[model samples]
Target: MFFASDNSGPVPPQVLAALTEANTGYAMGYGADAEMVEVTKRVREIFEAPEAAVHLVATGTAANVLALATLCQPFETIFCTPTAHIHEDECNAPEFYTGGAKLTLVPGLPGFDDKMTAANLRATIAKEETRGVHGPQRGPVSITQVTERGTIYSLAELQELTTVAKEFNLPVHMDGARFANALVALECSPAEMTWKSGIDALSFGGTKNGLMGVEAVIFFDPKKAWEFELRRKRGGHLFSKHRYLSAQMLAYLTDDLWRDNARKANENCAYLAEGLRRADAPFLHEPQANMIFAALPRATHQRLFEAGAAYHLWDGPLDGDPNEKIAARFVCDWAISRDQMDHFLALIA
Candidate 1:
């Protein structure tokens, strides 16, 4: 039972097939391939932005940092939650790519919820620009959908945060590494989740869904498209064999494959969540979209680990009392099967 991460899962057969088809002949280098043309068209069609600018990078870090750098200046500071992926996982790539821009973490209210509120964001933005040139200026506000704690933000929540940012005329960027999962969970249109909600740019992810490795950076305004291209090239993320990336993305967007994959993942998570509930496992947060944070007793965790179950422990020590409960993270990928989930739940039982 591999509930470790979606990134560790296998690529879909269709994606590999598309790669094989794209490998048959020579193609232009540096994003000029014909496949990329179709990929852009499909992305525009999906997001309903005819004038949107889309570019592919090999990793989500490249996508996030490049997009942020394009929308922000080096002297400014990006506002995000302390638990944001850019803050915790990207290893300062956002700061490095933005050419020395600082990250000012917006502290959430006193609660387990890591999602930033409009009032908190307003307070955070207000705290900045006070030090003049000595302190960093307020840059763009970055929102992480399906937040780090495995919670999905609602449309109204997004609009509220964006409205707060717009009060200061700040551009907003979305860290959409799990964009499809959140979209499917909310049952909202892509436009509603993004531009209509005041998102200026997005890091549209695919690797976590089923692709081998590809993430698209989309700018709704299209004004900073060239700057992003230069930044991507400078970061060495522009693949010479660009058709492979484009091919995977095209396959993902075609026949509603992306939506289907996300639905499967969410369904799997819901199934697992129900089983966990039956097993009396306490949830750290409600399973929202393909990810769960639940606490199982140390004895049960040890048993699962001995039975070859894979997952992440969110907190507490495994070596202490056997009855102690330790928080663990279980991620359901598109490829995870119900049989595997049943086996895992059986182990816990």
Candidate 2:
């Protein structure tokens, strides 16, 4: 049983079928294929924006970095949480792709929950932009749904964050590597969760769900589309035989497969979390999506690992006292089943 990451799971049949169909044709290269054309149409139709510009890349980093670079000048700084994937996980690709635009982490204020509210953001923008050219001017604000901390922002919270950015006349960007997961949890319309919330750009992820690799960069204001295309090419993220990537997304969006996949993964995590809670395990963060971070005794950890159940220990070693407790990071994927989770829980028990 592998609980290391959703990225490790097998792709759905839809994805492989689309890939097979794409392989049989001699399509145009570099995103000019018919499959890509359909993906753009499908994504726009779902987001309810006929005029929206949709572009596809193979990784979430490309989607976030390119979108931010398009929205910000080289001298600007992107504002996000210190725990945002763009800041902590992407190795400064956002900065590198944006020609060195800095990331100004918005430290969560006292009593603030999983999100940076409009007020906290207002205070941050006011404090940071006060430097007057001596420091980085305000660029776009990037919000990570299913935060690295495994918590989600409510629709009201999302709207509030976007409102804060709009007050500063700055565009908003979302690092939605967990877009489907957040959507399933929030149970809101794609438009309501994004554009209607004043989000100007989105990094719509597919890799963490079921696809081999694919992510879409969607811009509500289509005016910024071509510049992002150029930035994507410049960043070397533009796939040459791009139909493979486009086909994956096409299958993912068809018949709401992305949403269903996320729902199943989240359900599996909830099941796992229920089991952990029943065992009185300590949770490190709010288990909102497919990822769960919980602490168990070293004895339980050793028994689980020895039983071939794979996951990552977050805070302590595996070779410690049997009574010592430490946190572990567990990720459930779309393909994981209740039976598998049950088996894993039985191992720990």
Candidate 3:
């Protein structure tokens, strides 16, 4: 049983099929092919933003850093949560792409793990804005959907956070590495969850959902379309044989595969969370989408590890007493089955 991360799962058959179709004959290079045009059109239609500018990159990091670069100047700061992926995972790609822009982390919601509040945002942005060009001026507010702690920010919570950013005229950027998972959980339209609710740019992700590796940086206003394209090319993200990326994305979007894949992943997580809770395990943060952070006794962890189960420990070692609950993270993917989840639960038990 593999619960390490969604990243470890197999790609769906449809994605492989699309890739095969794309490989049949010659196509144009450098994202000039017809496949990309269809992918772009489909994305715009899905978001209900007819004028939105959409670009695809091979990694979530490229999409996020490039999008931030398009939104903010070099000296500005992007407001975000302390545990945001851009802050913890991307290794300063945002700063590099934005030519020295920095991230200012906002704190104090809960669970290291709760939603960012308007008060915190106002205070943080206010502090940044007071610098008068001395400090990093407030730039965009970057939010992570299905945030780092496996919790989701509700639409109201999201709107309120964005409202605070809007008050300071800060554009909102969502680092949506799990965008589909969050959207399915919220049961909201893409536009409602994004632009209509004050988001300016979104790193619409596909990698964790089921795609091989592709993410879209979608700007609601197309004004920066050319700038983003230029930045994408200059940053070396514009794939020379771009059709492979396009094919994967197209397969992801076609027939709602993206949503279905995320739903399955989320359902698997919910099931796993249920199993853990039934076993009297306490969660570090509640499972909301495709990820969960929970604690089990070190002995239980040892048992699972010896059983050949693969996953991550949030912190600390695994050589303590049987009753010492240590933190762990569980991520689910579409391909993980009921049998796999139950086997994992049994091993832990």
Candidate 4:
């Protein structure tokens, strides 16, 4: 049983089939293929933003950095939580892509998953630009849906943070690496979670859900569309064989496959969480979407690891005291079956 990460999961058959279909003939390179056109149209219709500009990249980091570079100036600083992917996981790609724009860490609510409150965001934004030209200026505010800890922000909570950004006239960006997962968890339409909530741009994700590797960067305003295209090319994220990316994304948007995958993943995580509860394992955060952070004894972890069960320990080393509790991360993807989860739970029992 593998529960390390959704990134390790298998691609959906539909996506592979679409890639095969797109591979048959000669197609224009660099996003000129017919598949890309359909992808743009579908994303626009799905988000209800008729004038939105959609572009695809092979990685979520590229999608996020390119989108942020378009919204922020070099002298400005992006606002995000301490645990945000752009801050912790991207290896300063945001700063590098934005030509030296820095990230300002905004404190989240105490004891909750790392989600920035409106008050905290406002305070952080206010603290910046205090020294005029000496300090970094305020730039776009980035919100991570299905936060790094796997807890999701409700529609109202999303709107609240965006509203705070609007107060300062700063554009808002969503690092939606797990966009579909958060969408399915919230039970909201694409528009309600994004533009309607005042998000200026989005990094629409697919790779973690089921696609091979393809993420879309959507600009709701469309005013910065050209700049984003140029930044994407300059950043070397523009794929020459762009239709492959387009094909995967098109297949994801077709037949509600994206939502279905996310639903299955969330359901799998829920089932696993219930089993963990029965095992008397403590949770670091509620299993809201497809990821869980729970505590199990080192001996129990060793047992699972010996059984070839894959996952990550969040606290101390694996060689610690056998009875010592260690928090670990478990991610459920769409491909994992109930039998697999049952097997894992049995090991825990």
Candidate 5:
């Protein structure tokens, strides 16, 4: 019973099968394969942006950094929440890739699970670029769809944030490392969540869902397409055997596999949340998509760990008082079964 992370889950059979099919023949390197062409077309159609520019990288960090670099200048600063992955988890990759562009933290609305409210975003943006050339200029505004805390922003909320960014004429970027999970959870069209909501670029993710490490960077307006291609190559993120990435993404977009995977993951989280609620486990944030943050006693955690249930403690160490409560993160992936969740819950009980 592994509830550690979706990154530790198994790849879907369909993605592996596509990789095998792509391995049989020689193809042009650096994203010239026929499969890549199809992948681009598919992503464009899916997002309803006919002129969108789509490129692939092996990691979500690369996708986010390269996309941000294309939108921001070195003297500018990106706006994001304190808990954003680009800010807390990416090890300053965005700053490095953007040539020292800084990140300005926007305060999250209280009890909103680390989401930046429009008023806070506007205030933060307004505070920047006021010092002329002395201070960092305001750059693209980055929004995390499924926030680092695992709570999702509704369509209206997304539009509200983007609208605030547009007020200052700044480009908007979405760090969508869990794009499919948020998409399926919101029950909205891809266009409605992105370009229609004024997002300029997107980090379309697949690795955490089911693929074996492939993420796409999509620019709704192709004006910076050439610059992004150059930045990707210079950043050493351009894979020579690019078709393997293309194959996995193609398979993910085929037959609604991406949506199906995310749907199952969200459903699994819901089921687990129900069981946790029944057990009187207190939640730090509502289980919005495929991730849960709940508080359990130290003794209960120890019991589950001894039983081989894997997860992360968010607040403290495992050696505290037995009755002390510690918060933990539980991630449900596409591959986990009801039996496994039941086994995990039984251990908790």
Candidate 6:
């Protein structure tokens, strides 16, 4: 049972098939490929932003850093939660891409894991731009929909944060590494989660859902489209074989495959969450999408590990007292089956 990460899952056959079809014919290089043209059109239609500028990258970091760099300047600071993937996981790629732009991590509520509130964001934004030309200027506000802790920001919460950013006249960027999963969980339209809710740009994700390695950066305003293209090339993220990336994204956006995959993943996590509750395990946060953080006895964890159940421990060690509780992170991907979930639960029991 592989619950390590959604990134570990295999690609859907549709994606592979699209890649095969794209391989059979010659196409223009760079973003000029016919497949890329279709991808741009499909994405714009899906997001309902007829004027949106969509670009493809091979990785989530490329998507996020390129998009953020387009919105921010070298001297400005990006506001985000401490647990944001750009801050905690990207290893300074944002900093590198923005030519020294700093990330100001807004502290989360005391009990929550780095999901920021409007109050926290307001205070954080106000604290910046105080030093005028001496201190770092406030840049865009970057929000992660499915927070690192696996809790999603509701529509109301998004409105509140974006309202605060608007008060500061700062743009908003959404790190939607799990966009499809969050959209499925919220049961909202793509536009509702993004531009309509005041998000200026989005790192539209596809790799985590089912694509082999492709992510889209969408700027609703499209004013910075040229700058983004230049930044992408400078950062070495521009794919010479661009049609391959385009093909994967095209398949992801077509036939509602993105939605179907996210639904299956969320359903799998829900099933796992219910089993965890029945096993008397405690949860660190509600399983809102395809990921969960749950607590169980170290002995039970050991048994799970021995039985070949793969996952990550959030806190505590595996070598402690047999009955001591430890937190573990379980991520359910689209391909994970009920049988795997059942087998894992049985081991814990």
lDDT of 5 by residue, 1-349 (tens): 8989998899999999999999996999999999999999999999999999999999999999999999999999999999989999899999999999999999986766379999999999999989999999999999998888889999999999999998899999999988999999989999999999999999998999999999999999999999999999999999999999999999999999999999999999999999999999999998899999999999999999998889999999999799998999999999999999999999888
lDDT of 6 by residue, 116-226 (tens): 999999999999999989999999999998888889999999999999999999999999989999999999999999999999999988888888999999999989899
For all predicted structures, in order, the TM-scores are 0.99, 0.97, 0.97, 0.99, 0.99, 0.99
lDDT of 3 by residue, 225-340 (tens): 89999999999999999999999999999999999999999999889899998999988887889888889989889888898888899887887677888899889999999998
The TM-score that candidate 5 achieves is 0.99
Per residue, candidate 1 scores C-alpha lDDT tens digits across 9-40 of 99989999999999997999899999999999
Which residue runs of candidate 4 sit more than 4 Å off their true CA positions?
none
Q: Which stretches of candidate 2 lie over 4 Å from their true place?
A: 109-114
Model 1 TM-score is 0.99
* Colliding residue pairs in candidate 6: none
Query: Which tens-of-lDDT digit does each residue in 210-246 have in candidate 2?
Result: 8899999999999998998888888898899999999
What is candidate 4's local distance difference test score?
A: 0.94
Between the candidate structures 2 and 5, which one is better when assessed by TM-score? Answer: 5
The lDDT of model 1 is: 0.92
Clashes of each: 0, 0, 0, 0, 0, 0
Candidate lDDT (C-alpha), each: 0.92, 0.89, 0.89, 0.94, 0.94, 0.93
Q: What is the lDDT, from 0 to 100, of the residue 184 in candidate 4?
A: 92
C-alpha-based local distance difference test score of model 2: 0.89
* Residue 230, candidate 2: alpha-carbon lDDT: 89
